[model samples]
Target: MSVWPAYAEIRFADYGEDFDPSVERTEMERGVPKQRLLNTDVLQTIEASVQFRSAQAVEDFERWYFIDVKRIGWFSMEHPRTGEPINARFRNGRIGRLQPLNTLFRFAKRDLVIEYVRAPQ
Candidate 1:
């Protein structure tokens, strides 16, 4: 699996835990309502902002993202909070537009949202 670039420094911008539970609702003989919840785990998604300090780094990221991942493949990156590698895919299969901090392209930044593919074992 492809790993995140070492040159790119990821900063956690937002973290969200998503929960969608299966619910069953039934009416009792006495006209009472009952609800049952299914067992499930909360999935996680991370919105991270990364900065590329040099033009070469930005170019490398573009190549990695577009060529290596093809924009829809799974990759591994260290979690900012847990500091463990996590399998993830691009959320909506896209990254936000990269913004250059200067005309010389010495620095750039972009935001990314990735969803966890599985829980850590």
Candidate 2:
């Protein structure tokens, strides 16, 4: 058996990208007021939403996320806007849910917060 858990393949069409780039700042006493030091790399946080029309779809995704993906801790994900692949994991401890108002439809929506993981040098 493979060591990796079997997770459902889910693609996100659109997502919000947050890229934060910063530099280390230090306060100087005598000459300079502030000193800007080391440059920090970009930190990425992606926010996405997925809608499941049926109960089966919801169950499948939930199992894949909470059981398989969550168990693995980290996985590769493709950025929706740039299409660049990055190592990412769930940002929040809990998943947001939105249930359809109509009982007949039984649709479910989930909002996901994914944070990119930096590689070690």
Q: What is the C-alpha lDDT of each candidate?
A: 0.78, 0.58
Model 2, position 23, has a per-residue lDDT of: 54
Q: Cα lDDT of model 2 overall? A: 0.58
Candidate number achieving the greatest lDDT relative to the actual structure: 1
In candidate 2, what are the lDDT values of residues 1-121, reduced to their tens digit?
A: 1121223223366457675555565677667666463444555677776566666766776676676676436766555566667677777655566555357536666676767744333
RMSDs, each prediction? 3.7, 4.9
Candidate 1 global lDDT: 0.78
User: Residue 87's C-alpha lDDT in candidate 1?
Assistant: 84
**lDDT of each residue in 1-121, candidate 1, tens digit only:** 8998898877554444453444578988896799986544434777778888999999999899999888999888887777888888888888888988787789888887777744334
Best by the TM-score measure: 1
> Which residues of candidate 2, in runs, are more than 4 Å off?
1-14, 27-40, 101-106, 118-121
